[model samples]
Target: MSAGFSMHIFFTRFPLESQFGGAEVQTLSLMEGLKERGHHVAFLGSCPVLLEKCFALSVPYFDLNIGPPPVTKWHAISFLWRQFLMRKKLINAINEQPVTRNEQRVIFMLSLSEKLLLTTWAAQNKIPVFWIEHDSIGRWLRWNPWLPKLRRLSRLATTVAVSDMSKRMYLDLGWNPENTVVIPNGIDLRKFYKRQKILRSTTFHIGCVARLSPEKGVDILIKAVKNIPNIHLTIVGTGRDENCIRKLLEQSTLETHSNDEGQVYHLSPTTSVTILPSVPDIVSFYHSLDLFILPSRDHDPCPLAPIEAMACGIPTIMTDACGTAQYVENGKEAIVVPAGNTEVLHEAIKQTTLRTYEAASVQNTFSFERMIDRYELLFAHSAKL
Candidate 1:
């Protein structure tokens, strides 16, 4: 096994044709990094968009037409039947290239069933398999009846967690700690660079890029900014709670105006809350903000938003629930607050607005080169086994 070994990366839920998120970006960047390091990298998935992107990058890719998982009983049965067909397609794709024993490896980020199927195939063929866990342990691993079988299959593969928190969760869920590796997600510094800090505007612009969902705590952000003067919040991305969040904002505005008691609230007419659907110009979105916030209520495994903001030279306020908070100092790189505490978040926002921080202090820690080097080490080690 060497640094130039061939790697086959597999992801079942790659949403290439639709809106891509942090996970997609991380995966693509990793592939590019490996390619740049002179390794032969190939992607195997069902996403047409992914295939298209791979083609554009001149990377080898195979499409298995593995659409979204089945939701109904009838569809589940059909999916099982199609699974057999997909297995054949996958085998043929892998067999297309014959390499030395230590020159081939499989990297998978897949659903439980797909993982089990592929790992079994890999093991039978004496190929090393690595599983990257992008999420914390959840009911899927705890309550599923396939746990015993999945655990057995997992023993034959190396598991890579995205963060230390995620690794701990897997260990708590009975995954073998020795076989699990923690690899933090990295950002492409070239795509997100620090811009010249602009002078303060008449109204401060606080922006967030996240799905409008309960777990993301966008409502908490809205509530925190309600009475704050001259601070406008821009929320980007759409989700199931879009309508609900809009209604909450509208009602809050109505209530505030009605209770003004003939006194001006100090909130400027243009100082408003804006919700945007997903946009392609995310780098521009980060560059337009005076500050960025990630008010997650749930334990986000490893959020890329704050890191991206840091790279853009925008100070960020992220809740303690974000795993990336480990890399940030309270008053240095970012303002870390307790999750779900609106009052604390409000105060943190006010405090951060009074100060400026250096993005270079934290940007180097999450560079794509460092992340790639670590992955290369892990892959090379796995290949030797």
Candidate 2:
């Protein structure tokens, strides 16, 4: 059966236009596919530009909240305080605002307050709410006070994790296994998998599309690149670790040109390393890459970049920290390495580059359509009251 159910889906906060990450892009793509399949979908969140883009795809949305202003501090303290306040205010704001009873609202949340509001509202009103689990599992467990509330509401709603790792996380926390489903992120095949004339370049354009955070393990990738000569690395996405990454990149460059590795490690960057900001031309981004690397130090539930890269016909090198790595074969679709190990990461990159894997073989099992189809089935089955 197609996604033709007569239902309305309300996603709480969709990062419709933020070029910084993949969650919003996946959400927008899913909404578009759902609309095409005859489901009525709408969103309530910040990112007006992204919201409008989704609307243009015939997925109507309402911007009901605004994100907190960007700040400079990258420490855990900054994240905790800001996230705490943001969630608190958002809960108060959304709670005060009235929503219609007829709407089948699925509150999208990046913070505790949003989760609380949606969970509470869904339980109180008997709405069939679904939590689209994003971010790391550790982050969810970090907030001690909310654990009881989550457990209490666990029976009231169905939770959908983007990856198997995320599903395991909920189960590990004693969440109802019957109430949880694993629906991975998808890609727009028509756009990202289009036929394009290939351009040949000497410098292997190895691309990484992720936030420049320490947890992302970009430094590991850089170290690997230094070991492998004559390749340029392109990092996409912005975050708190920009300065640290720049310094690391400079040191790697110095190491690359220097005779000694130790001497190459000490030099600092005079200018910020030129990192290309997030872009809308994801099709081009994927098309231009020889390899896509996800070097995350923490276990990322289901990262879209690797999947998207495969869809775009580019081979990938992913770490075991990525939950989606389980979906891939070691020597087939993509290579998986230990998290934070530069040696393994470097070897994986070298091997993939040397013996280029067939793009069709890598993409055959992991299409965006397949991922969406799984979600459609899960949603239909779980929507039962």
lDDT tens digits, residue span 1-385, model 1: 2365666544443332344456666777777887788666777776665667778888777776555444334544565567676667667766776555545656565445456557788888877777777554555457655566677777888888877877777777678888988888888888888776666678888999887768789999988887777887878877788899878876766422322222122234545677777656889888888889999998687888899988888889999888888777778878889999999998888777635567564555788888888887877787677
User: Please, what are the lDDT tens digits per residue for candidate 2 over residues 133-232?
Assistant: 7767665354555576667677776777877787887888878988887777766566667335576676676889898778788878777776565566
Clashing pairs in 2: 12-108, 16-50
TM-score of 1: 0.84
Best by TM-score: 1
Where model 1 places Cα greater than 4 Å from the true spot, the runs are: 1-18, 67-89, 96-102, 254-271, 359-364
What's each prediction's TM-score? Answer: 0.84, 0.78
- lDDT for predicted candidate 1 compared with the true structure: 0.72
